[model samples]
Target: MTAAITPTTREALARRIADLALAVPGRVRVAVDGPPPTAPVELAEAVAELLRAAGRPPLVADARDWLRPASVRLEYGRTDVDMFLDGWLDEGALRRELLGPAGADGSGRVLRRFHDAGRDRAFRDDYTTLAADAVVVLAGELLLGRGLPFDLRVHLRMSTAALGRRLPADLGWTLPAHERYETERSPGKEADLLVLSDHPERPAIRS
Candidate 1:
């Protein structure tokens, strides 16, 4: 017989996993509603270690899909079918090309395609397409654990202007909200508390 759906237990497990990620730097666990990335073996290993440290088994998960281009966007609270359709594609066709096998069902095909396509897009497009804010929030909740700070910094390494091009005017946002600007610039075109070092200089080497 199948086990009963235990959302509460799963949530608790999710929390524990996040906590482990916090304890173990350079890693984070995310629970999304669609298929996550399949490449980057290191990412998968890091996630697995986090779950193991939390006394749980790593399970399959999915991330959410963006409905449109960021240039013609809407707030998360708003629903625009036209924009959504623009981002939408035939999942079955996409999956057959990517996986070499038919997906389990229509839902699975769509999710797989979303994951596959998302990895190839620009940073802003990728974040919006995958609702990366949700991933950040979950990671923050896990890292901060309890008594989370009123404000948190989530770093994104790409450039804002480049990323913004993929978004619709209404859907795109400035630093802190969008991944492109979150790391390099804060509210005032200045550096935020968190800095992303794409290239780091060593003191000994420099001197």
Candidate 2:
């Protein structure tokens, strides 16, 4: 059984990630992977603050911003589980724009975003140059098992019940994708840090 956990459990995780940033030699690339119900980006933002407090610069990138344009994404129609899992995200852009450039043998400059699917256009913003020892938090769903290179990875895991219970009716279609991710990717297995995040405020850690 999981131990009784407190509200500070999430904060404790933030601090733990901050420690990784301080201990690691160069820019630490971190992946925060989970379905929206698990609030992966919330955890990503929290740790980015802790990283800043710890004096290691931090950068944040969301997977939504790297989504392919509407034409490519909606080719099969919305609510397609297969497309959501495989077709929507532009992994190449993510790697070239954010992950690769921030990695070793590359500059620390990173783009804030590539394409905004909502507007169906590309971002015209320039790159932000971070310190060489910065920490980049890339947060989103279905991020694992894709072979994206990262120094550290965290997966915010949610039980099927909790995920379905937490998500609203409009997003009910997304369940199968999340389910397949757990089965195929086994993010909990890929993650260096695993978090039980049914209750975002009081997350439990698997022993």
Candidate 3:
């Protein structure tokens, strides 16, 4: 069974993100939890489905890949947070980590490009980084419309079941949740959106 994110851990992460949002002007925060083997594609697909399920506005870009003339792109990878916080690396490292080039550049030119971009942020995990990037993009758009003094937060959690549930159903692979095979499970992280939806002080949706 995948170990669940304990209540304490969730609270800590939430608080950490909340603190970050409060501190950084025009910044966004996001948190995500899921099984370790979750593919990047599965993560992308689930975010798309969740947006639809939640009736969220259409994302400025398609979740599958880059959509257009956007300069800031998001690539997914793990990072050493301390090194990032210490300002040892720049955006180039982050670009290479998040999105370099489609194929291998034998000359490592893309890596050099990433290194040139100037790294302003970093994350410890790929999932969290993806969530943060989505929020950052959304936050930038919101700034153009609503102006500042706002904090944007997004959380994306994927499950082998929930993310890929539609597939097995389509393929006629009928197995109960209890009986289905699960690998690299996160164990306890249930969806937090339901809890937030029930929050009495939940923030109103912004335009």
Candidate 4:
């Protein structure tokens, strides 16, 4: 079992992310990737908070918000591995509505959210103009190896045992997809930063 992360360590991580946000002169995009049970969303929130406190406007985009419609996600059945691996997230929609606009080459205006998966409807067009030094944090599972433009990439990793222990029974079907990701994409090797997240309270930065 991993040791618990001290409060000091958590703060340090937040500061590190904040520094990365300010490293570039223009809009910066960051990705925090991990399985849902690993709670990468919490890390994104912490980073965003730190950036805002440091006088930078930060936007947090949740992958869940950009998920494809229920019909599309359920096409191969709710528990289909292929659906979880490839068909779940609407990568095209994300590129069009959020990533493209916030990218370095594109306009700095980003749509905070695009669709509501639960309601399976389009979200209201709430576009925000990012400052030249603003930061965007996108959090989700399997976010790496997708060729998305991100200035900083962080991957939270858990062992197979840890994942199985943390995952709910209903969501257990997605385990194989994650396993495939670990073997094929090797996010830990691809990420700019890798966090050993078997024990959420005691996460450690892996070399």
Best by TM-score: 2
Off by over 4 Å in 3: 1-23, 29-61, 67-135, 138-155, 162-164, 168-207
Off by over 4 Å in 2: 1-8
> Comparing candidate 3 with candidate 4, which one achieves the higher lDDT?
4
By TM-score, highest first, what's the ranking?
2, 4, 1, 3
Identify the superior model by lDDT, candidate 1 or candidate 3: 1
lDDT (10s digit) by residue, model 1, range 46-67 = 5455555655433222222221
- lDDT per model vs. reference: 0.28, 0.85, 0.27, 0.83
RMSD of each: 16.5, 2.2, 16.3, 3.2
Candidate 4 lDDT tens digits, 1-207: 774443326657767767877777778889999998778778789999988888888899899998898888898888999888988888998888778888878788778787798899989976888887788899999889888778889888888889999999998988899989998888888888788778776777765
Question: Which residue segments of model 4 deviate by more than 4 Å?
Answer: 1-8
True-structure lDDT of candidate 3? 0.27
Q: Using lDDT as the measure, what is the rank order of every candidate, best first?
A: 2, 4, 1, 3
Residue 172 deviation, candidate 3, in Å? 10
Encode model 2's per-residue lDDT on 36-106: one tens digit a residue.
Answer: 87777888899889888878888888888999999989898899999999889899998888898889666
lDDT of 3 by residue, 86-144 (tens): 22323333234332321122121221112222343322332322222222222110111
TM-score to true structure, per model: 0.25, 0.93, 0.22, 0.92
Better of 2 and 3 by TM-score: 2
Once model 1 is optimally superposed onto the true structure by TM-score, how far is the C-alpha of residue 41 displaced, in angstroms?
8.9
Error of 2 at 128 (Å): 1.8
TM-score of model 3 vs. true structure: 0.22
